[model samples]
Target: MPVESLPLFPLHAVLLPGAALGLRVFEPRYLDLVRECGRAGHGFGVCLIIDGEEVGAVASAAAFGTEAVIEDFNTGDDGLLTLQVRGRRRFHVHKVRVRDNGLQVADVSWCEADPVEPLQPEHGLLATLLHEVIDKVGGEHSKAPESHFDDAAWVGWRLAEMLPLENAQRQVLLQTGDPHQRLQQVLALLPE
Candidate 1:
C-alpha cells in the first residue's frame, strides 16, 4: 500500500467518516496547520489522543484516524478561529514525527472503502435510532441529503457519529473497514 505524509491533530475525540466536527483554534502550531491546509486545498488527519493532553506536551495518538477537510471557517470575537471540518476517509498510521512545536506528522495508508450493502431487516431499529439522534442534534449537523439509512456503510458511519460510545470505541469503529462488522459491533454494544 502506498503511504502519504499527513499532518496530525491529536484530540480527545474521534472523527468518523461522514461526520462533522467543530474545533476552536488557538494553539500556534494548529493555527499554522489550518492555514497550510487551506493554502494547499488539502485536509489533515485527526487521531484520538491515546496519552497526554492537547496542549503543551507531545501526545501519543491512535494509529487509526480520519482525514478532515475544512468545511467552514469563522473568527470568534475572542480572536480565535472556529473551524468546521467534515471527516473524509480512514487511514492507518505507519510512522510519526513530532515537530519542534509539538505537531505530529504521520506516514499513513488510506483504508479501502467498504462495499455498500442495504441495511438488513434486523437492523431497522438502528436506522430509526440514528434518525432520532440526528434530529436531536439539529442544524447542519443533521443528516445529509445523500444519507442512506438503508445502506450498511451509511448506517454504520452515522451510528458511529451519534452513539454515546467512548472515543476509543468510536476509533475502533472507524478503523473497521467492514460495514456489516462495524454495525454488528455497535449492535452488540447497544442496550438490549
Candidate 2:
C-alpha cells in the first residue's frame, strides 16, 4: 500500500474515530499547520504524546493515531485559535520527521474499518449511557439519524471516548480494529 504523509499533532489526549476534540492553538507551527490543513481541506493526524511536553521540543508519539478535520474555528480574546475537530480515520505511522519549526510530519497507512455488527443485548447499558451523554452534549455531537447505538463499532467508539480510561488505554482502544473485541475491553474496564 502507498503511504500517505500527514502533519502530526502529538498531545496527551487520544482521539477515536467518530469523536470530537477541541484544541487551543497558540504556537506558530501549529497555527501554520491548521491553516494549511484548512486551505487544502485535509485532516491532520493526532497521536498521544508518549514523552515530552505538548509545547517546546518534539514529543514522542504513539504509532497509531486518528485523522482530525476542523469542524469549527474561532479566535479567542487572548488571540489564540480555538478549534473543534472531528475524528475521521485511524492511521499507523510508518516514519516520522520533524521540521525546522518543530512540526512533525509522518508517513502513515490508514487502518481498515471494522466490520459492521449489531450491538449485543449485553451492551444495552452502554448504549443507554451513551445516549444520555449525547443528549446532554447536543448538536452535531448528538446521536445521528441512523442511530449508531445499534452499531457495534459506533457503540464501542462512543464508550471508549466517554470512559475514564487513561491515554494509553484509549490509544489501545483506538488501535483495536475489532468492534466486538473493543467493546469487550471497554466492558472489562467499566464499573458495575
Candidate 3:
C-alpha cells in the first residue's frame, strides 16, 4: 500500500519490525524530527544511504529503510534526546518534501516481501557456521539452532541485519529483493 509522506533518517543499520534500536539524537535536524513525530503522533523512517554524497544532511536523498516508532524518550541536560525506537515496517523512499529546523520530510512507499526458493539441504552448513560465529560473539541470548533451517525471509533478514558484517555488505543484502539471494550473499561471507 502507498504510505503517506514521512520523515526519513537514513542510517547504516537495518531494523526489522518489532526490533528495538536505540537512537542518540544530537543533530539539530534530527532532534527536530523527533519532536515533530512526538507531537504529530507519527513515526519516521530510518534508511541507510548506500549511495549518497550526504547522509542525514537532507531527507529525500537517503536510501531505503524501515519505519520506526518511538518507544521511550528523555531529554538530557545537554538538550539532546535519548530515545528508543521499535521498527515497524520496510518502506521505499520517493522524495524529500521538507528539510528545515533540523527536520526532514519525505514521500515514501511500503515495500512488499518477495518470494524466495526454499533453503536447500546444503544451506544447513551455512547455518552451522553462523551458529559458531554467534557463539564466538557471545553474550547473545542464544545460539543459532543446529537444525531446522527454513523460512528464507526470516532467516535472511535476521542474519543479514544481525551479523557483524560491514555496512557495505549489509547494504547489498538490503538492496536485494529476493530473500534467498540475501541469504546466499551472507553465506558467501563465511570462510570456505
Candidate 4:
C-alpha cells in the first residue's frame, strides 16, 4: 500500500499495535489534529522520536512509528484534551513535511508483522517482572492466568498495557516490529 502522510507528534515514546496510549493535548496545532481526527473518524500515526531535537526536526524529517486510533476522549474545562489511543499497525517513517502549525506531516508505510515465534528468555523474564509490579501496584492484571504470555503478540500487548513506562518509551516498543526486541527492552528496564 502507498504510504500516507500523517500529523506527527515527535515524543520520546513508542506505541505498539494492539497497545493503548494516553495523551493530554494542549498545544494548538495538536488540538487541531485531535479535533480533525475526531471529526473525520480517521486515525493518526504515533511515532517515536528515536533521537533528535524535538524542535529542530519539525519538518522534512522522519520518525519510526505506528498507526493508532483514539479510543476514549475527554475534554477538560481548560480546553485541554485527554484521550486514549490504541495502536493498530506498525509503520516505517520516510519523511515528515512541516506545516505552518508546527505539526509534521509524516510519510509512512505500514510495516507488516513477521512470522510469529516463541518469546525469548528475556521476554519471559519481563513478563515475570510485569506480574511482580502488578502485584505491588494492586492491579487486577496479576490475576490473569499464567498462560497469557505464551503468545508473542499477547506478551507484547500485555506488557505494553501493564508496564509503568512513560508514553515515549512505550511508543518505541509499539513501533518495533520484533516483539522479542520489545520484550528484551522491557526486560532490561524491569524494576531492579
Per-prediction TM-score, please? 0.93, 0.92, 0.75, 0.72
Misplaced by over 4 Å in model 2 are: 132-142
What would the per-residue lDDT of candidate 4 be over residues 1-192, giving only the tens digit for each residue? 797777776655666666667888877778888888888888887666656744444533235677779989998778768888887877777876777888777778878774466777656666666667667876445676767656666677667766777876675666567767777777776667
Candidate 3, poorest ten consecutive residues by summed lDDT:
140-149
Distance (Å) between predicted and true CA of 43, model 4?
A: 1.3
Q: What is the lDDT of residue 134 in candidate 1?
A: 78
The deviation in Å at residue 81 for candidate 3 is: 1.4
lDDT of 1 by residue, 25-141 (tens): 999999989988999999999999999998888899999999999999999899899999999989999999988877899999999987878888888888888888878877654
Best by TM-score: 1
- Report clash pairs, candidate 1: none
For model 1 the local lDDT of residue 154 reads: 87
Q: Give the clashing residue pairs of candidate 3, or none.
A: 10-47, 29-102
1-192, model 3: which lDDT tens digit per residue? Answer: 666788877665666644578887877778778878889999998876555433345433345777899989887778768888987767777766665463557788877765545666656666565566556665432444533346576566667656778766766676677777777888888657
Clashes of each: 0, 0, 2, 10
lDDT, model 4, position 135: 77
The per-model lDDT (C-alpha) reads 0.89, 0.90, 0.68, 0.70
